[model samples]
Target: METDKKDKLIIALIIGIVIVLSHNFVSSQKSDDLVFENISSSLDDKKQTKLINNNDNKEKNEKATIKKIHISGEINKPGVYEINDDYRLEDLVNDAGGLTENADLNKINLALKLEDQMRIIIPNVNDKDNNENNMTSQLISPINQNDNKKVDINTADKSELMTLPNIGEKRADAIVEYRQKNKFNKIEDIKNVSGIGDKYFDAMKDMIVVN
Candidate 1:
């Protein structure tokens, strides 16, 4: 009888041990699965972050490659101007020394796109005596003209020559040089400048009088 009881107790203990081991095994497997899932999620987040950073770097590099622009002409102050790729004409004008006293705002379309090494020429005000020498210069045409005559570029001073449309210090100088070199044969001889085209000549034809 005692042997039977001992055998029964031994069987019960063995069954209890098997149940505990099975439960622990299942719990361990669940823990392993949870750990693996967490690792995968972390890796995915890191990859996304890397991709975003790479895109940002590419954008920055593209912006760095864009070149700046420079401009010069009859501005309040004329000089080399450094402008960003997206900069507008108005912005560039402000950068390269603002408009000069006689700068004709109408002559320049401020909305124009700026190009590299582009020369911007600001025209003198119409019917105005304004010039570089005077920023606050006012428009005042020669009130006293000889009867039935107008001003002559061949003999006009720096200030007087500017009264003609598109005539600036540079053009005025060219006129004087041409007059001295070849001597004025006729008023039409004033077209030797590098920039003076037929259109400009037509505009100034009436304003100029050969002395």
Candidate 2:
């Protein structure tokens, strides 16, 4: 009877150990499953964040590529407009409700590429004096009949300023704005304007004079 009790006790101890090991194995498997799930979730979140950032950057670049231009004179609707960088003068004219009946298309270069902060003036066929004042109109034909005569920096309009070599609309506008606040005492003083450095001044120094 004693031998039977010992065998039964041994069997019971073995059964208890097997049950504990089985429970431990199940807990460890559950822990591993949770770690894998967390890793997958983290990877998914990172991918989503990267995608969103790329989209935002794309949108910002598109906005940066847009150019702002101002159009006035002899147009149905003359105002500042936002246009694509690739837009031409004709495109901007159409955007401003097209040119009026009095607009002289011959004086304007419709194929000219538009630039940021550019001002466009459509000339009127009947207004000869006003057409002379129009920068765009003057650009098509030289206002100064004699090339030998130097341009007066102090009295020169935007179109006259643009007559200088390497001087575009932007630089011409800058020169006009600078002159409004301060007068050029001498021809060298033209360099004081922004974007008109030594090289640019050298190119047009002979063509400009201050009275």
Model 1: colliding residue pairs: 75-100, 76-99, 76-100, 128-139
Q: Write the per-residue lDDT of candidate 1 for residues 1-211, one digit (tens) a residue.
A: 9999999999999999999999999999999999999999999999999999999999999877664443334466655566666767788777766777766775566776665544344555652422444321111122223444566866887777766655666666777777776755566767765446554565466667776
Model 1 weakest 10-residue run by lDDT? 135-144
Which stretches of model 1 miss by more than 4 angstroms? 1-27, 30-38, 45-49, 64-67, 74-87, 94-98, 116-211
CA-lDDT, candidates in order: 0.63, 0.76
* TM-scores for candidates 1 onward, in order: 0.39, 0.58
The 10-residue segment with the lowest total lDDT in model 2: 137-146
Question: Model 2 TM-score?
Answer: 0.58
Candidate 2 Cα deviation (angstroms), residue 60: 3.0
Q: In candidate 2, list every pair of residues with a backbone clash.
A: none
